[model samples]
Target: MSDSSPLPPVRLHPEAELARDALSTPLLSRAARLARWAGPDTRVDAGGGLVDEQLPAAAELLGLTGDAAAAHAAEAWRVAVDTGLVEVTDEEAGTVAAGEDLPLLTGGSPHDILAVWLAALEAVLADATVPDLDDLAEAMDESGEIDFSRLDWDPESEAAFLDGVLGNLYLLTVTEDGPGDGPVPLPALAASMIVPGDLGEPTNDMLEQISDAMMRLDDQFRLLEPIGLVAYQPVDEALMGDPEEEPAAPLDETDVSRYGMVRLTPLGLYGLRARLLEAGFGAPAVGDLVDKGADALLDGSSGYGPLAARAETQQWLDRREPLAAARELLAAARGSDEGAPLRRLRCQQALSLVGAQAEPAVRDVLDDPELGGLARVWLSELGAADVPPPSADLVYWLTIDTLAAQLAAEGNSEELQTLLEGLAQQHSGFFAAAWRVGHPATADVLEAMGRLHPDKRIAKEARKAAFKARSQQGG
Candidate 1:
């Protein structure tokens, strides 16, 4: 995802609810338990990890039993120390205590709890980038420091690769056309990073690269899941028999899950958005424009998808009286700027959500040159009584405005092409009079119609009309 463009607005659960989820995540919950369980008896190494001798005891305390139990206990202890839930009191003696942030988990506001969770998320993300301890041990040099070159790892690139993967997952979760809550196949997610957009077929090398990345992500997501970042279904253990083998292709539709599937949890959405904002990305949320003015609402949501725009408009309308909101929207919709047409289009959409109470406001704008057509359409749709018919001039002006708005919003989409064809079929003399419409977008709309019309003769007429309109304006 480009940091330059704003991400699709996310619909986050309330902070209090998210905080509850954060408090329940396996890693954070284990860390919090260890924080409460810690005392003068709890010993740590120089790095603040639980001493090896105490790992079994810690694991038992957490009711964890198995070959990997000690490792899990050690991971939780590290998170406790990293997040300040368990602070080392004496470096030399290795004494520890419940840190300053521990009590805040039980007593403080939702924001405070989430703040600690974000810190823990950062720690987990950092850990996910490192090679396994066994690998590091094997790469240890004579002086005892692990040789990163031997490990074939670049710290910066590893972190960036993980960040990029999570960023893509976040994009997928929030985008309208993406699978919002559905699990994305792990191979597909990995391929998004490895494969270029324009690549038609994956080369043997690229497929191998994607396979390697998938294994890396499998490990990473396993670490991330305990912290509530993702709900991951690990690649089937049966598929991991030989690392040298080419990635297995799913035999059937049901077999795809064998490769793995993953989705961001709701808590993950909140965490990623916060991180994106801190990193200087414009990550908007659905209710962000609720308290802003109508102009801001229309302008801010002009680039939003249909669902997000409606959601934002509804939230903005929920706080104001219908009539006043309608009036404000109509007032904001009247502009000669290049963005005015879409803003008015968005305004019309917003007004549709208003009820009969806004009928007066709609009627008030019936004589407005810029907004009259919109007002008439709204009133006519609402089945309001005694609405006057629009003149030929007003109809032509409205047509230009509507087409301009569609052009701005969808950019010569198939739907616009269909609309253009229908309009030309309905009115034989459209291009002749469309060139004379007083709307600022008249020439541009005519030019778009010329480009979009399927019929060659009508297209030529549209081009001629556009030229005439531009010449008249230039004068």
Candidate 2:
């Protein structure tokens, strides 16, 4: 149907609306009933407005096997207690007994179940309430890679939520699974989960739109950037409106959400549902999602710090904007030339945020080797361009001394290689470090470096170390 096709009316109340407002206006209802029942807040005797008598069949509806269903119900009950989304009171006589399952009914079809999950997630996100990690895991696992074809949502809504859930779940899982070194970075996890086929049979245009939206999400929220790299919930200010105030629906017709939103306009829902019915839309391959994420990050944010700069840069990159982050950094640095070292540092940082792309400019700042140690070091770490190998032999000797001392603790040949590779691509000096470590005295020594390099060079040197290790083992 055309975008302006006649729509079904909003059907909140069949009683009053029968004679009033145009009945043709399509009404998109929610899946809260199903979500409430299936969510962690539902227990056998309490929460989710469920009665004890409903337990047995509810378990069956959930498709839980035997005692597993009971267990699931109980866990939901416990979750209810913990999150305070619901409450349980002692029975004063025979009003209701503990351990009894409430009879809950839902018009929820498969798509409805999916819709409910998306709605819940959106609620939690908007409220900044962290989702119950375990509950989501169960849902995703049970759903098993997800097939929107069988789901009950409008096609657009389905695609939007699928993308959103994938993004969020990927981030949450990564945070928990990541090495406990720093604030959980969604990018790393997003990078891992995103791979081919994750978009199912998405068209190139759809992918581009999603990419652009993700980049925007990244710029607004750094922690969420990597997740955006895969999936995202684009805020439809018109649809979602201001949570604290305003009517239940949006007033603006022009405003549309790029990412999936729990609430959708009639047209949006219509489009989504229609797409769901259309053939070819399938489960996106995890590998493809990951690759997309990696490509975005690699090309988007070169390398600065605070991590937020990368996030912002990613936004522009996603749009395929001509003003790439590298040029942006250069402009910033050139503008701040007369400022304090702090300003220079900030500009450098901005450049660094652009990563390897800004290396040349970074190297240009180090004409005076005496004051360039720190700058050169940063360039080296990021694999930036070089400053002509320190023209003076004495300076070269000092540079080598400093480098050797700094790297004295032993290094992974492969990890060093990767690190130097980034730099070597820009400045040949970093490659030297990788080469030096590649020929370390022994396999065990190189292995030790791979295992213990404190500077995070292991990723860079791991391969070279492996090669050297095999060579040594053979000899």
The best candidate by lDDT is 1
Q: What is the TM-score of each candidate against the true structure?
A: 0.96, 0.26
Q: What is the C-alpha RMSD, rounded to one decimal, of candidate 2?
A: 21.5
Write the residue-wise lDDT of candidate 2 on 326-359 in tens digits: 4444333332111222223344444554566556
Give candidate 1 misplaced runs (Cα > 4 Å): 142-144, 243-254
lDDT of each: 0.93, 0.36
The clash count for each model shown is: 0, 59
**Per-residue lDDT of candidate 1, residues 300-400 (tens digit):** 99888899999999999999989899999999999998999999999999999996878898889899999899989988999989998998899988888
TM-score of candidate 1 versus the correct structure, residues matched by position: 0.96
